[model samples]
Target chain A: MAALVIAEHNNQTLNEQTAKTVTAAALVSTPVHVLVAGENCKAVAEAAAKIAGVEKVLLADNALYARMLAENMETLILSVAEKYDAILAPASTSGKNYLPRVAAKLDVPQISEILKVVSADTFERPIYAGNAIQTVQSPAGKKIITVRTTGFKAAAEGGSAVIENLAATADAGLSKFDSEALSKSERPELTSAKIVISGGRGLGSAENFKLIDKIADRLHAAVGASRAAVDAGYVPNDYQVGQTGKIVAPNLYLAVGISGAIQHLAGMKDSKVIAAINKDEESPIFQVADFGLAADLFQALPELDQELAKRGY
Target chain B: MGSDNSMKVLVPVKRVVDFNVKVRVKSDQSGIDLANVKMSMNPFDEIAVEEAVRLKEKGKVKEIVAISIGPAQAAETIRTALAMGADRGILVKTDGEVEPLVVAKILKAICEAEKPDLVFTGKQAIDDDSNQTGQMLAALLGWGQGTFAHSLELTDASAKVAREIDGGLQTVELKLPAVVTTDLRLNEPRYASLPNIMKAKKKPLEEKTPADYGVDATPRLKVLKVSEPPKRGPGIKVKSVSELLDKLKEAGAI
Candidate 1:
């Protein structure tokens, strides 16, 4: 029995999470099939077909799936559910919305945010906001899983898998999309970025965030904020990175003015290299940081900016 | 709207380790150490109960029922909800961790009997962090769902919900008899007043079992192990900004 990976995309460019999810799916079973369901998402399907682990791309291009509503996506996935023993998706906000519905309709339990696939029937996932890891064994039958994108490397792109057109489309007429107000940013997305610079309440005010922004612009890194900073209205809610917020695992994560709360640590503890700059040397963030600098960010920012500029960054 | 029209809302709450307390894995590796841990209503579920209460306060809803599925101690969580303004509560007495699917199925049976127009829950429980029950319940009832809702407005037959997504916010309109899971920005939950706490003790409370709903309470996923995540090693302090940059560059982090 093959695994079915539901691709994450915006009908234009395929999301990097899909490739990572395909890698996790391949760990469970071979002949990995990716279901690209959206309106006019041929390019996205083509991109999925090029992922290394995908064996087939099933494209369901229709108006009904354009928004990927949970009710409609559940109906569509069930139409092709027979051939798959496992259904997987990246645990994005969108995937978290729809996959549980599919699982419920199938009368199966879902394994959320799986970090590792130990075997076909067993897996490891974080619980209590990554404070503890629980290894779970799924009952024999069907497995529904959501992959934590940071856990697995993105599958490489070199193969040419065939894309098969899927004719199934569904509309439950239960909900209607109204409008969206997405934050527009020129920087890289926080979850998938190579480097990230996050500000905390110690930065003082929304206007003072420029200190973090200038460095982020120089390094071409995504900007994130501690929940305290976001709660203080220094940034929008989406900029928050912590428990109950976005989880990021970048190669280089720089914390500025952030007091590391346990909730905050839950999100970024997986970073490869962590650096923190704070006046309080005893801050908990220093515990997890590979490198720490006890200095006032107000004075340090200008010097760091000057140094980076001198180095031609 | 006729005089007989009375909108009803059902909110489900879970009792878990309080948000402020640091959770620790048990020495035996069975589960979290909860011997003396302070237990409270899951924070997200508290928001859900508050949302329902606000609806009833505005005369948009006639009744608000809070429900919980856990041990006998979970009844106290329901009392806390009642103090926050739920009209009544139903406690499904179950012993251990009930997976989201089973919880949803039990809620489905409760919905059939209660016939509430709206079901509200915390987006996810802090313990398991499985954001699945509301969507699963919505699926089992063949109704629409709005998850991670930060803002919601109700009409006689529809609900307009503003949800928080990864990149930003998205709004969706769901028809009547729907499920809504709340996010942090929905509304600040009110502290249970001392007077209300006394009144909640007098409020009607009903108890049942999972067997009453005819849903098996067995867990499908077996826990092979429980362990602490690897800890980050101690770090070195750099004296100057230039020194910090040099060390970062040495580690290929620049």
Candidate 2:
């Protein structure tokens, strides 16, 4: 038996996380199958089939799975849970919401946000908000896991696999979709972005945070914020990159006007290159940064923007 | 508007290291040193407590029951919740760290008896950072869930919750008796005053063991090893933005 990866997609397009999850699946065994459960997800199923390591695609396109609601997903996964040795999903909101449910229903222990796969049974994850790393062995028959999308390289798209239709499961009838207020952005998704520019409470106001966007736009980077910035109404909750928010490991992560809180460090400390700009020279962010510039962001913004523009960035 | 003063709210709090303290991994790499560490209520749990108290004060809720699962010292965490106006607390005593699944099972047992109309918990504990307890409990109880909820408006039959989803907010209407996990921006928790601290001493705190709930505290996953993350080399200070850009370019960070 092989790992069955739950594909993350929004009816129209598959999320990059599905490819990353496919990579995690390879760590377990070959003959990986991507399960695409959504309404009109044939294209997403085809995309899943193209992921290099995937041997097959399980498509359960149904109205019940339209929103990836836990109620719907829990049933869909259990309907096919018996065929696989392990069930894996990207640690996205939808994944987290349903994986645990599926695990509980299957009476198997579930691991959250695994950073490394030591073997099919052993894995490493961060505890104490990434301050301590623990290698754990699941002493169970079935393995249920949520793979941290940023931890693994995405499985390249170049294969053709057979797509099979799965019989739909009954809706649990316990929950309903009311509405969604998704944050719309032209920039890249924060988790997958190569570069991220994050701001904090020091930005002062929502309007002042535009300085972050201007610089991020110049580099085609995703804009992120600390919990303080989100709580201060400077940005939406999804913009938060920290222990309580999205964890990111972008190629270049620049912190502007943000003091590195331990929780915040837990999210982006894995970035390949870290840079910090703050008025306070003693900020903890500088401690983790590979490059530190102790300067007022207000004074530095214009100068940095000008330099980047001059460089045609 | 919903029925005022009839609903019971349940808030689960976790005792964790103070948010300000920098944790150090132990020499043997078993885990972080906890001896002499100053611990407090998980910050997001504090938000949950505050939200519950606000609902009570607004007459939308009649009772707020706080629950903590850990060692006896966790009672202190519950005291803090009571001081924050949780009305009462129940400390589910255990000696060792219980994984999220077992913790959820214990809570499920208690919820079966308490029959709270609502359940609130921190989205994730800063300690384990597992982010699974509430979701698991919701799964166990077959309750509607709104994880990472930023705001919640209550009604008679359901709660309209605005959750922080990637790139935006997703508002869901969870029917009554739902599990709502709090995020950072839910609400600012007020500091418990000196007087409240005194009053909280008299507040009832019931102690129970996992056995009382017929649940096992045994962990499902075995810890193979524990270690500190790789340390980043000390950063070099750049004198100016132009110099910083030059350094970034040289490092191929741009």
Clashing pairs in 2: A182-B168, A183-B167, A183-B168
Off by over 4 Å in 1: B1-5
Clashing pairs in 1: none
Best by DockQ: 1
TM-score of 2: 0.96
Report the lDDT of model 2 for residue A224.
95
TM-score for every candidate vs. truth?
0.98, 0.96
DockQ of each: 0.88, 0.72
Model 1 C-alpha lDDT per residue in residues A174-264, reported as the tens digit of each score: 9999989999999999999999999999999999999899999999999999989988889988998988889999999999999899889
Off by over 4 Å in 2: none
TM-score of 1: 0.98
Best by lDDT: 1
Report the Cα lDDT for residue A116, model 2: 90
Worst 10 residues of 1 chain B by lDDT: B1-10
Instruction: Write candidate 2's Cα lDDT for B1-254 as tens digits.
Output: 24778999999999999988878888987777999999999999999999999999998999999999999999999999999999999999998778888889998998999999999999888888788888889889988788888899998888888887765777778877889999878898999999999999999999999999998888889987889888999989999999999989998889
